[model samples]
Target: MRAAEHRRELVTLAYPVYAELLSGVTAGIINMVWVARLGGHAVAAVAVATNVENLLLGVIFVAGSGTTVLVARARGAGDRAATHSAVRGGWALWAVITPVVAVGGYLCREPLARLLLGGGEGGSLRLATGYFAIALPGIAVLFATNVVDGILKGMGDTRTPMRLAAVANGSILVLDPLLILGCGLGVRGAAIATVLGRSAALACGLVVLHRGRASRRPAEAAECGIGSLGADARRTARTGLPMSADFVVRMAGALALVAVVARIGVDEVAAYGIATKAMYVATMAFYSVRQAAAIHTAHLLGAGHDQRRAVGRQALLLSGALGLSALLILLTAAPWIMRAFGSQGEVAEAGALYLRCLGPYLVLLACFIALGGVFEGSGASPALARVTLCGTTLQLALAYGLSGWGLPGICLAMASSMALQCAAVGRMYLRTGRMGRTERPPATGSEADRPWIPAAAASDETH
Candidate 1:
């Protein structure tokens, strides 16, 4: 693709993804708004439950992301059999995982509730259990929707999934009040509303998958060695596991960093939490770009191009612009942002300080994350995952060692680690550019399932 074309394609794919992510945030906010009418305990209940749901999302990525990469690659290769196998693999993985979570979770609702709320018979626990009783069972709908989204994105149509999210979350915004207050189901009503909205969306998604452009390929085309269902599942797992681990590792590291912040002071911890939450606005934008890059990279690779260098450059440019914009916003508006959150005194001061110091980290993170997408799409995610683990560990150690300086120290630690990650990714990018289309050794089993290969590798040519 030309420079202009790359920009256009990346933007075309990215904006809808950004909208989809924002709608998800909107759904949570809508739920919170309605639940707040019940009381603080009810709000607390929904919050904790949603946090757990977020973690569960990571589990589902094993299927969703795996399917996306495989399908995109297949589409690029014009391999209908591989596309079919990829779709089946995603569904197969979902089927195996959903029952364990949805069924087992319902049976242990009370214990799970207790675990999140620290074991109490308080109103929060009661409300949490009530919410889980409905939400846990509804995990099937969520899983199916996610799989559908993955399949569509793999087909190179991100717009439909974005529209689906808007439709489902939009319904939740409309139904939450009617179910929660008007229908008198309380917290359980919120869960029901969410499930109903998502189920409706899922139904729409299935229809699209059956009739959409993604499914239009002729069935009698060459198989291109698409694996069997079980093999595909394992391959999908292998391809996606590193991406999943990267997410989980980041989450775990963030949580651990909170503990490190606690060593400073309670006020600092509160400020750190609030500042981090605020940072998500910027971070999610970076991630949106990352997803766009991944999808585009995979699609191009499947189509027999190795434009990782070009893709990486464009991704960095896009994310770097956004990151710089965020830096300016945070720098100029940190005080007002803290006040907007109703923070006061030391909390506001500390948060502003952290935000001001956050610029370097955000810029580095945007570059790293966006570049990491190329690695993911090209089946080099294990390396990215290793870098993430190393960076997270280094950040925590530095944070703990620099706790005396409070939030500023934490920001410095984060920036330092991110810088290291960027450096590592840069080296890999240079190597890929130099190597061009050199053939790699043939992979076995799950690794062979990866659809991406250098031109030589795919063409059966020896190096």
Candidate 2:
């Protein structure tokens, strides 16, 4: 594709994803708002519960992200069998994974709450367990919705997922106050509202899955003769494991960094938490760019196009612009942003300082994340995952060592790690260029092992 075409496609694919991600964050914020009214214990409970949910999300990414790339590639190849196989694999993996997290989580809710709360005082622990009682079991809805969104996005239908997110989160916004305070259920009420909203949205999503454009394709009519459930689940797991690892590793690093910051003082830890949430607005845009690049890259590769260089360049450009924009906003608006979040005193001061120091990290992180999508789409995610793991380790080590400098030091650690990650990825990109016209092989062995040749050649081979 030409540069202009590539730019346009990236923008088209990215905005809706940004909206979808934003809606999720917005839903959490809304939940927090309602829960906040219940007292510090209630807020703490919801926060811990939400963090657990975020971890659970990483677990589901195995299916959600795997299905997306596989389906996109197959769709581009116009391979009906491969497309069907990809979908089946995603569902298979989901079927196996959901019950484990949901049921197991419910069974372990109290211990889990204690662990997250660090065996804290009474009210918060009980409240957190209360939330988890419903939320853990309701994770099935969250897991299923993610798979549905992934499938739609893989089929190049980002808008529908965006709409579904709006529907789901919007329902939460409406239900939170009514359920939490009006119904007098408190923390459990918040959990119930969240589950009901997500369940309704999941139902709508399933309807779309059955009757929407992606599901109605002529390719859907073709028999894929996909293998047994176990085989398909394994295939999906293999494709998605690196992506899931990358996410979980990063989350683990963030959580660990919080502990590092905690050594500084309660003020710094509080500041870090609030600042991170504020930063999600900017970071989510970067991730959306990454997702778009991945989808676009996978589609083009499956269609026998080797345009990784162009795709990488465009992704960097888009995400870089976003990063720079975020930098400028944070630099100029740090104090105001902290104030907007209702922070004050040392917490406000520390948060503002952190925001100002966050610019370099955000820019480097955006570039690395966007380029990593190219690797992911082309099945090089293991390499990217390794990079992430190393970077995260470096970040935590640096954060602990630099705790003397407070939140700014933590920000410096983040920037330093991201810079290393960017350098490594840059070297890989240049190496690919030096390797010349040879296609970077797909990351896995299934049908993707088939070499990409001309459409005519592929058809001839099939015949």
Number of colliding residue pairs in each model: 1, 0
Can you tell me which runs of candidate 1 are displaced by over 4 Å?
216-227, 433-452, 456-463
Model 2: per-residue lDDT, tens digit, 27-73? 88899999999999999899999999998899999999988988888
Residues 141-236 of candidate 1: C-alpha lDDT, one tens digit per residue? 999998898889888788998999988998998899999999999999999999999998998998887775565443532334445568768877
lDDT of each: 0.84, 0.85
In terms of TM-score, how similar is model 2 to the real structure? 0.93
Candidate 1, 178: how far from true, in Å?
Answer: 1.0
CA error at residue 244 for candidate 2, angstroms: 0.7
What is the overall TM-score of model 1 with all chains considered together? 0.92
TM-score of each: 0.92, 0.93
